[model samples]
Target: MARFAISDLHGCRQTFLAALDTIGLNKDDELFLLGDYIDRGPDSKGVIDTIWELERDGYRVQCLKGNHEQMCLDGTKDPNWLPIWLKNGGRETMGSFGDHMPDEQHLQWMEALPHYLETPGYILTHAGLNFRRANPMEDQDAMLWIRRWSQEVDRDWLNGRIIVHGHTPRTLSEIKENLAYLNHLPVMNIDAGCCYDLPGRGNLCVFHLDDQRVTFMPNRDR
Candidate 1:
């Protein structure tokens, strides 16, 4: 069975599904979603529904928590975070639900999502780790919101396993240029800016862990 990872879906359900189809994902194959499943695009509710259905049908899925998901969860607990969340595409997610907000099940699912996952060959997370920290596991904020700090590190910090994460969206060329492979440690970014509808942006990316293959599905909204 193949192992794959995709990230920064941003409510683009059609693109997400089409990318899976392109990868020929089957029941036995594993899919690791690096998060940002909601907001910015047209069908946040549909995206969540599809993922739940996939899991119920026995599809293997590991969905990580993204910064956007944190914003959504925080908005539910604190009134002050509502406006900030809305300003960053949470309004579109709310609109996708029509009259009501996220149900209890959805909230719980988002709340319980783990910050990171580690396997023999790869480290999976929503955002890259804070390499400067003594223990990145303690830095939830960096895991969800980090950008340049993780990308610019000159030395390999993962020992040998590569880091596969999303959060900072880059064009295909930019990602290729920035992808690091030094001392057997690689840092791969696959966000693709799917929410941004501009030329180089707005494309969903899927990376196959076993074969190191990268594939793309253009955004439907674009």
Candidate 2:
């Protein structure tokens, strides 16, 4: 059995499907989805529905919560978050829902999603932790929305576990260039801006853990 992870799917259902097809996901293989499943792209509902179908078919899929999802939850609680969410592509997500409204079951699932997941070799999260904090894991806000990190962060902050995260859009070249010795720890960012229609972006990426192989599916729009 193989293990794989993908991030920043947004709502590009076709691109996501193509990535799955490229990866040849089977019952034996496990898939970790690192959130942003909705927003910024077309067919947010389709993305959620496909995930539910995959689970129904007995695929081992682990879904994580993303900042966009946090925004979604916040929008439900406070009227103030709606405008911010809408400006940041929440309108596309709502449009995908059409007249049915956001699914309650999905929202509940999103609410229960863990902020981070630990594995033998890596720490998985929607966004990277605040290395500057004494206990980075305790800073919930940084785990969901942090875009930049300092070079002076504690190198041993994670005790040797590399952080694998999304939420920031960086091309493969950019990721490689930026993987410098940051406080002696390394971070791997896999969000290739799958929802974007611009150059140097808009590719769904999947990383095969055991083999350390990366596969990509170009966005349907491109």
Candidate 3:
């Protein structure tokens, strides 16, 4: 079975589907969505529903919370959080949920998502983990939202598994050539900024863990 990781969907339902099609996913394949599923696009609801459906159909789908999702959850607890979230394409996310605000079910689902997922070879996170934090659990904020600090920190801080993260969009995928000794790991950034229009069209990154093959589906006219 093939295993894959992707991130920063940003509500592009068509592109998301297209990416899956390009990857030729099978029933046994596992897909890890590195969060930011909703926001910045016209079909946030469709995106969420599609993922839920995929999971129901026996596809091994794992989801993690992104900063956007955190903002959505926080908005429910504090009115002030709404503006910041909305400004960052959160209005679309809210629209996806319809007139109904987040209820217990939604909160429970969001809260249940882990900040980081670890496997023998890779660690998946929305944002890179804080290198300085001795324990990942001790710093949930940085785990879900850190950017510069995570990138600038020495790679030696990463422990064991290769850290695969999305956030801090880059023009191209970054694969570190060297590994630091802390945990003997390298960090990789795969968010190709699919929602933003620049350099190239929207991209959905696909990684084949077993084969070590990485490919991307560029934004195409729908």
Candidate 4:
């Protein structure tokens, strides 16, 4: 059994699935999804549906909450957040559903998702932690929304475990460069911007946790 992680689906269902196939995931292998399953590209509802399907099929798929997921949940609860969510590509998400809204099951699933996860060798969160905080792990909001705080990572707090996250989209080259310097910088961003179709973007990334392998699947949801 192996462990794999992918992040920032951003509604690119085909690319997400293709990445999974590229990884050759199996039931015994654990799949950690670093969230942003909705918004931006296309088929947000379908992406969530595929996650549920994988769980039902006995795949060990664990999903963390992303900023987009938080925005989606807040948008449903408050009117003010609705426009912000839509402006940030939530409109595309709504269009993915025939009814232009998420169903109860999907909403509840998103609502119940944990913001962060910790294991022996890795700290998994949608976004990086706020190292300035005394206990970065305790800052749930930072886990969902913080950006550009990687430089502040509290190395002593992390000891030797690497931090794996996806929120701030970076080019494929930048993502690979990060892995090369993993010995010095313990944080890695695997988001290749599945929602972005621009240069150096649009590839969905799969990070093999056990052996530290990276696979890039080109965006196909265009």
Highest lDDT: give the candidate number. 4
Quote the lDDT for 177 in model 4: 96
Clashing pairs in 2: 155-183
What clash count does candidate 3 reach? Answer: 0
Order candidates by TM-score, high to low. Answer: 4, 1, 2, 3
What tens digits encode model 1's per-residue C-alpha lDDT throughout 1-222?
A: 989999989999888888888888899999999888988998888899999999999999989999999999999999999889999999889988994678888889989999998877888999888877877767888889998775554454566777889998899777656454433447888889988967798888888888786887888764
Best by TM-score: 4
State the TM-score for model 1: 0.93
**Could you tell me the lDDT of residue 172 within candidate 1?**
79
**What TM-score, computed on C-alpha atoms, does each candidate reach?**
0.93, 0.91, 0.86, 0.98
Span of 10 residues, lowest total lDDT, candidate 2: 175-184
Per-residue alpha-carbon lDDT of candidate 2 for residues 1-222, written as tens digits (9 for 90 to 100): 888889988889999888888888999988888889988898888898899899999999888889999998898889999889888888888899993448798789889888888767777888878877778888878878988873445656667667778898988666545454422556777888898876778888787767655777789743
> What lDDT does the true structure give each of the candidates?
0.85, 0.81, 0.74, 0.91
How many clashes in each candidate?
A: 0, 1, 0, 0
- Give residue 58's lDDT in candidate 2 (0 to 100): 95
Off by over 4 Å in 4: none
Show the colliding residue pairs in model 4.
none
Candidate that beats the other on lDDT, 1 or 3, i.e. the better one: 1
Writing each residue's lDDT as its tens digit, candidate 4 over 163-187 gives: 9999999998999999999988999
Model 1 scores worst on lDDT over the 10 consecutive residues at 176-185
RMSD of each predicted structure: 1.8, 2.2, 3.4, 0.8
TM-score of 2: 0.91
